[model samples]
Target: MSDKEELYCIPSRYRKTENLHIVFWLVKDLCWVMLWKPLGLIMIIPTLGAALLITWQTRAIKSELLHNVAVVFWITANAYWMLSEFYSTDDSLRYYAVIPFSLGIITIGYYYLGLFSKKVR
Candidate 1:
């Protein structure tokens, strides 16, 4: 197999960094969904950390550029949501926030489709 092909192949064992990445995101998302009210908008701290760590983990992958961009949008969306929750009552800001969130999701979908789809075999 070519180096590029090998690089794209899924690893047999999950790396510690990868596991941490998953755990971080899980905590982040759960906190955002469940604890946001009690946490009083401070939840973005851990979520931002999770996003940064996930972006760091993607650096080892072949599709790092796409992953990084997606993470950026994800972080931006989270920030917008947090800001709207804590500070902004502007309805327009809420509507604008969807753009980055949707873009982030779409980029992640594209990355998975392009690199990890079963059809790629």
Candidate 2:
């Protein structure tokens, strides 16, 4: 087995799909941020789709469990932020949105630090 396959255990095909999904996800977020008013939050649709695809790709590899969970948390965070942006009339929902957002960030950081930071031995 190749070194990467030994570490990640995911097929190259799924890895490529995951990489593409991540790229699309970032682009979607960029669009959402740049055109928030003019796009009227429509970018979330594609972002959500990309997030879902990423989560799905993570499912094939057991080593990616934490990353999968982080992606799920990210999706929840995005949902909360979207709700706060489009539907909330009070400050409470906006405040609530921060919880998931922070958790998502922490979890993503944990996943990267715990997994990606380790050198192959």
Candidate 3:
């Protein structure tokens, strides 16, 4: 750390929401791990909703926005995977979780590439 180093700060309100979002996400996953089908199914609402809100709030910050958007996709994939396990008559739908998972990877890749390009200039 140095005096010349740049600092990035998020508003307390946003931070609080982000913290609460973690709780929601954890609860969702815990429900999944515990195999509480009905409660787990319902937890996706707040989990995904908070991810969306975080993405929207950080839209002005390109790097943050990119990461947050990926989080949204991650949650989507997680929820889909959980649902597949819960509602499936067979074990096939879980394989499709790759779709959203891949999207999250691509989003992160794009962010790193963009950062690298900026440094190259």
Candidate 4:
């Protein structure tokens, strides 16, 4: 091939790059959600203690962590407004709290799942 033509040559269709991008992101999200919320919060202390056993474990200051932390706190605080419904029994207020809590959980899961794949490198 001439030098000019060589630059334009494309690779054969047989070669395909493996894409794990979506999968990695999903894993990060799952971890974040499962670790951040109250159910997950209960596990955090033990989780961190376990991490100390791994000398090579890398720590990343991911924005996702900050985001998840905010979400967890937000949901927890709103939970009072949630439970307050039981006193006077206003179902709507309690129902409203569910949305934020659910959203926070999903965000946490999505973001944290991405972290696992990142740390491997």
Candidate 5:
């Protein structure tokens, strides 16, 4: 598909998401908190906390961009978590929780990146 078409196209599930664009934007607000949580002593609890925050932000946002980011993050995290838990038996198990939380960081990072990415500047 053409880039323009891809940009304009809306999915059936996201038709309702447009109303939440601002709340979705708020997900970026927790980037530092997410990063610090993983490094703290009680890692598992922080991991769960990050996941819950992302889940909450996804539900709170109405924008298609935010929805897409949230859905993609959720799917990727769950897949990795399941694979690590069932398929791998290594020291990297903590990543199953950490990587998912990283998505929120990425989402926030994107907001800043995209701000400069626009040609109008």
Candidate 6:
């Protein structure tokens, strides 16, 4: 990173929310692992909400925005996958998580393509 880029600072309040977001995501996944269907499903609300909030907070920086948007897609896919298994619908629905997973991949790919391109400014 350049000197200017290295100087970029994330506000403390936003950083706190980002950290909280991780906690919520972990709780959601843990509930899923323990097969606590009710709490696991409920946890999706806060987990996804936090991800959305983080994505919004980082909207000003292209790299951060792209990565955050990918995270939103990831949580969405994860939530859907978890719900599918919880409902015993995995046979027909789990694979659908690929949609959002692929979206996340595409977003990252777009970010990298722009970053690596040799186009003149």
Q: Return the top candidate by lDDT.
A: 3
| lDDT by residue for model 1 (30-118), tens | 65666455453555566566566656656677477577778778777866775665566676776678999899889889988877776
Model 5 clashing residue pairs (backbone): 17-62, 20-61, 20-62, 20-63, 21-62, 21-63
Question: Candidates 1 and 2: which is better by lDDT?
Answer: 1
Candidate 4 lDDT tens digits, 1-121: 6767735222342112112322333443454444434433334333333323221122233553446454454445343442343244566665566666667666667666766768986
Q: How do the residues 27-119 of candidate 5 rate in per-residue lDDT, one tens digit apiece?
A: 332432453333222333334344444455455443435645655565456445544554466858847666766885678677667766775
**Candidate 1 — which residues are off by over 4 angstroms?**
1-38, 64-72, 109-121
Cα lDDT computed for each candidate against the true fold = 0.66, 0.64, 0.95, 0.43, 0.50, 0.93
Candidate 6: pairs in clash: none
Between candidates 2 and 3, which one is better according to TM-score? 3
TM-score for each model: 0.52, 0.55, 0.96, 0.33, 0.35, 0.91
Residue-wise C-alpha lDDT for candidate 3, range 1-121, written one tens digit per residue: 9999989999999999899999999999999999999999899999999999999999999999999999998999999999999889778879899999999999999999989999999
Candidate number with greatest TM-score: 3
Flag the better candidate by lDDT, 1 or 4.
1
Ranking by TM-score: 3, 6, 2, 1, 5, 4
Instruction: Tell me the TM-score of model 3.
Output: 0.96
Tell me the deviation in Å of residue 120 in model 5: 21
Instruction: For candidate 1, give the lDDT of residue 79.
Output: 64
Name the better of 1 and 6 by TM-score.
Answer: 6
User: Residue 100 in model 5: shift from native, Å?
Assistant: 4.4
Clash totals, every prediction: 0, 0, 0, 12, 6, 0
C-alpha lDDT of residue 76 in model 4: 52
What local lDDT score does residue 97 receive in model 2, on the 0 to 100 scale? 64
Taking the tens digit of each residue's C-alpha lDDT, what string does model 2 give over 27-55?
65665466454343655566566666666
* Deviation (Å) of 68 in candidate 4: 5.3
